[model samples]
Target chain A: MNIALKEIVKNKVRFSILGSIILLVSLLTFIISGLANGLSQDNASLIKDLPSGQLYMNKEAEGTYNLSRIDPDIQEKINSQQKEAVAFSIQMGFLNDESGKQRSVAFVTSTESKLFQKVKPGEIVLDRSLEEEGIKVGDTLTHDQFSGKLVVKSFVDQKKFSHAPVAYISMENYKEIYRTEDMQLVFVPTAESSLLFKDLQSFSNRDFLKTIPSYSAEQTSLNMIIWFLVVISGMLFGIFFYMMNVQKIGLFGILKAIGLKTSDLFKMMWTQMLFITLSALALSITFSQLFTSLAPKDIPFILTIETTLQLAAVFLIIGFIGATLSGIQMKRVEPLQAIQQGEV
Target chain B: MLTMDNVRKTYVVGDVKEEILKGISMSLHEGEITALVGPSGSGKSTLLTIAAGLQRASDGHVLFEGENMTTMRPEQVRNIRASKFGFVFQFAHLVPFLTVEEQLILMLDVSASKMKKNETKQEINKVLQLVGIEHRKDAYPSSLSGGEKQRVAIARAIIHKPKVLFADEPTASLDSKKSNEVMSLIRDLTKTLKMTTLIVTHDEDMLRYADHIIKMSDGKIL
Candidate 1:
């Protein structure tokens, strides 16, 4: 709008340096943000998509899905209040492939679930990530050193979670896979059968995640990693830009002496920094997503627009703060020096 | 025209109370070229800065066409300078980021919001031609020579077509030939525009251009 602004915008070297820095910060923040989001989803993707209004798991178990087994008596109380009850079998352990390679996986007892109800006997839904390790339909998955086997029935859209994949299977199929009859729960797919079981066992779906020992801890750790990235991105960006401004004392004084107001000059600096940050972040984020799509399956990087927006907002905020603190030296410019210092 | 009435300025250096200018009085006429001449410690630049409203006088009034500028707010003073005054410092402090054309336009871009782009551009071209740098319009300050920079500074000073042009040692950085060229251009431009001009210099060679020369020694006007 003014000479100071026009000059800054037109000055390629200064703007390029600033813009590139903002872009790097934005990209880093966005990637970390994406990973943070991806991490949380990985922790709960299987549970979050379950169709049941409530899931019943053992309150006595260490975790929601791992150690929790519904006390067979609570099923009766849950059935009296609901039209249907589906017994769910949740298991977490390693499953070996035909090639003798093992991968960590979660087993969902095939009960008619609201969210993921399509289950057939001898069939397993593979997590999206494990698809790379020779996982496909008709492949046999051996559980616990070949104690049992189940044919991979279908590979659904469930995401690649942190380090494991989820498989949904019928109780009979899960029983054969796990080599145990301890998972005696039935999915209340039919309305009438649910009432019969509810009189004997307690159940719920929403509180299922709370029953897992590692669920909350896993989520918190992933979020902590994400939060760490958020912080460092802005801090590094602000420091670099602040230092750049600190080096321009002579330029600022000349502008002030020639009657450029300090506030306007500051606004110009902030606007310049913001423009740079926003553009760079956008460019980096767009390219990163393309890279992610072309990357190998095991690398779990998921970028979303929501994550990018959050990252850009942070970059802009940090840029403004840095430019503001950096421009504090603007007030210290002795305008008189511009004139009093001899022309030599 | 610019006038300072019995103006006084003081400086504080710890316990020392040093008076820079002690009751200096002078009146400069419209369209007349005036020189403020003094030794190093005689407060010539101090008086000039106060008259330009860049600094405040400890006492007395500065008048521009009978307008009491002494009590004017900084904003008011800034407006006065933007609309009524042009300044040429000893050093041509052209914004390094801008070209010679942009440097001249910066003065006319008084408000950071709205700019007089067309008029300022027209004026820049006119002044460049007047100062004889029309050929070097696109050149940056870093690319310009010493005399060329002073010529650009003079071009910037008259770009706004202010009521008065203030030059503090405008020729101090230039050789004799360049100084004559810059001074003649200033005088010719001032006469053509009929704007009052003032210069503060220790250069006695420049004394010829001044219609009225105020001599200063020890903060006293002679």
Candidate 2:
């Protein structure tokens, strides 16, 4: 006799209200988490796609990547010492097409390495997003400061920086446009943390991303909202079961009087919690995944299976704690009181 | 058979001590119905609860089949209550969500009965028929009338075939006609099952069904 399941089946309206609330809360959480991830990818996919490594910037830059300019001598020395090391620089600029349409882009130039696209002085590589905006391979695009026309060589996928498309240009063109020969940073691929360079500070790939303005602030706020929703769902379970348990106090007392074990009562409560949570989560996962596929192209939304499972696990654990907290009252009920209090 | 020797129950409220049952001794024989009749707060209900192991006596010995229940551990007592004792409260107190059939099934599960599934179903139907409510076995407590709900409660109490049955104001919520029906049903079941039955009630008309009557007042039996 599965009394837990029987009760749920008997009281459809009461349980459905709780199930719908959980469904809405979990769906909102998944969607928000997806947007946060999408915005993160849009904000810094260029740096995020790099292999795990150490980034060296001039110590005087004070954690600001744009302000950091690595000396040419130090860059060359590290490049010679670590064969995999690459020196790179990025600057926000504009590219004008043949029709004079100005498109914002992050101009990037790096030392000869397989990690970045190699472009000739008179050629450029563009991000795929720019190709979608009417810029194509072999199109001649010019910059205001360089005074030269560079043909777009090809396009790379997902290479974005600071919410703008990346344009891989030659070091010579970059120097001409920005007037600097020194690169902003040195990246040593698969480098150990103990390695140190004089007059420079080191940051891991993850810490380096924090140096990008708006990245940390944006991610922090979105993550806070996701966690708040998770916690509120837990509290919802606590209060819901608390109210339900309060209403059933007399019933519980009668059951207890009739020789039902306290552990049996707890088992019933747990079974109901699992049933409700898993059902709501299954629906929410299905709906959120559907939203991911149907979302507008301009909307940054990327919900991964791994993140969904992790959040689901958290909701289950928190719900268990919440329901168990409310069940403490069941252990305190005296059958004599219910017997004396009259009908259940 | 069950025996209560010098049973005393004391309740304390705000530094004031009140004795509800003052060292009362009684015994219930097998295959008989014993009624504890009294006015309000006469401790008949309290005595019934103590004998049924729902609570502990402040001081006394409760012996069931020659085993001292008051000295046993709480888990052991609860085990006895589940496997050897049955209870019917003042109100029907039927589980609101369960149908009449499921209520009996729940009791069988609580008692850890060894009957197979088909046998258990047969036993439930048998008890429901004995209480004259077999036609309403599929109904929930809310759908049942006052008389029908009490019949289901009685069916649940004895479905496990317990050795002792404890009822506290079993038909207090029903009218005089329905009360007599319930009382007669209790008497017939007690004799038919050969089970020891102890009931607490203040109604004088119900005493005719009891083979033995212990009237209580001011915490002492007269």
Candidate 3:
């Protein structure tokens, strides 16, 4: 006979209260996690989309990607020695359409490499988000500093940098528009060793992303909230089970007196925890997945299957730990004390 | 038959060593109800729990069917308690979540009985009928009357046909008429099942049902 299941069935209202609380908390967690991931993707999808490698910049730039300028000699030597190495630069600027509408964009230029879009002189590839805003292929967009009008070549999906749509321009046009001959950064795809050079520093892709202003601070606060929710849910389970276990001490003693194995008592607690957590997770996962799809276009809410599964596993482990800690009382209860205490 | 030889229990509080049951020796025969009567601090409950394997005696031997229990491990003692001994506490202590029938089924499971599913159901029905609570087999403990709860408790106690039955103030919560009914039921079941019974009670009215009454004061037989 499964006494644990019977208890849950008999006391439906009480267990439902607990299950509802868990469901709400889990749903809130999943939603917040989705927003955090969405914001991260919004902020740095350009760098994140690249293959793993090292990003080298001038050490004198003081960890500011915009201020970094690699020497022409160093950039050329590193590019020749490393396979698939590309020298690139990004500058936050604006484009003027035919109606004089100013659209913000991160102007990007890279040497010959398959990882980034290659455009000829006077042509530009823009992020698809700009197309959603009414721009189209072959539309002429002009920069104030350049003499010639650039025609839109095509659009790529999910190409963003620093919360702005990226515009890939030719290396010659980038030099002419920015009035600079030196590239800001050098990226070597899948490079294992940092190149030894004077007056240069190498950063992993993740470390390079932190050099972007506001990315670290933004992600740090959001991640802290996510983890705090995870921990709070764990503590909620602990306190809830502790209260239930306290209420059931007399009953546990009597059961032990009647020769119920201590292991069986633990199994009952674990079964209840698993049931409650999995039910709540199922509801939350479904709703969160729905939220990811139906959320407003402006809202960056990306809740992926992998992230949801990871968080659910943590919740289960933490719930198990909490319930097991509360059940320590079951092992210590003496039947004589409970019997003398009268009715349960 | 169950025999307790030189059973002793001493509890140390702070710096004082207080002996609760000092060198107590007793025997309970099959088909007999032996009542242990005493004042509040006379250790009657302690002795009962020790004999029922709910607690360990500090020193001495508890022999059941000629095997020494004091030397056995806790799990082994618990196995014997589950299979060979039945208990009814001062309160009914029926699992609040289980119905009357499920309570008996829980006992059979605890005892690790080898009876088939149909056999187990038949046995539960038989015991429920014997205790006169068969009609309420589907009722939860919360819905049962005080007297009815005690009857279910009794049915749960003997569902697996234990050799020894222990009752510690089994009717302390019932009225005078209900207590008499519970006592009569216990007495009738003790005779019918040939179970060795040990009961601890404070009410003088309960002593009449005991086949051999042992008066205890200050942990010793008087």
Best by lDDT: 2
iRMS, candidate 3, in Å: value is 0.8
Clashes of each: 34, 0, 0
Q: How much lDDT does each candidate structure score?
A: 0.71, 0.93, 0.90
Residue-by-residue lDDT tens digits, candidate 1, B1-222: 677889999999999999999998889887789999989999998988888888889999999988989898877877777777888888887777788887876667753324356766676778889899999999988889999998888887777778888899998888999888888888898788998988999999998988889999989897
Candidate 3 Cα lDDT to native: 0.90
Quote each prediction's TM-score: 0.83, 0.98, 0.98
lDDT of 3 by residue, A205-312 (tens): 999889988899989998888888888888888888889888888898888888888999999999999998999889988988888889999887889999999999
Predicted candidate 1 versus true structure: per-residue lDDT over A1-344, tens digit per residue? 35545655567787777567656655665665566556556766765554554444454543334555555456455545554655566666777788988788877764454655466775677775667656887888777634456788767675433346777766677666666655434444323324443223334443555444566676567666655655665565567556655555666665666567777677766766666666777798787677667756545567776766766676667657756776777777766765665442
Summed over model 2, clashes come to 0
Number of the candidate with higher DockQ, 2 or 3: 2
| Docking band of candidate 3 | high
lDDT of 1 at B122: 71
Docking category for candidate 1?
A: acceptable
Error of 1 at A178 (Å): 7.1
A246: Cα error in model 2, Å: 0.7
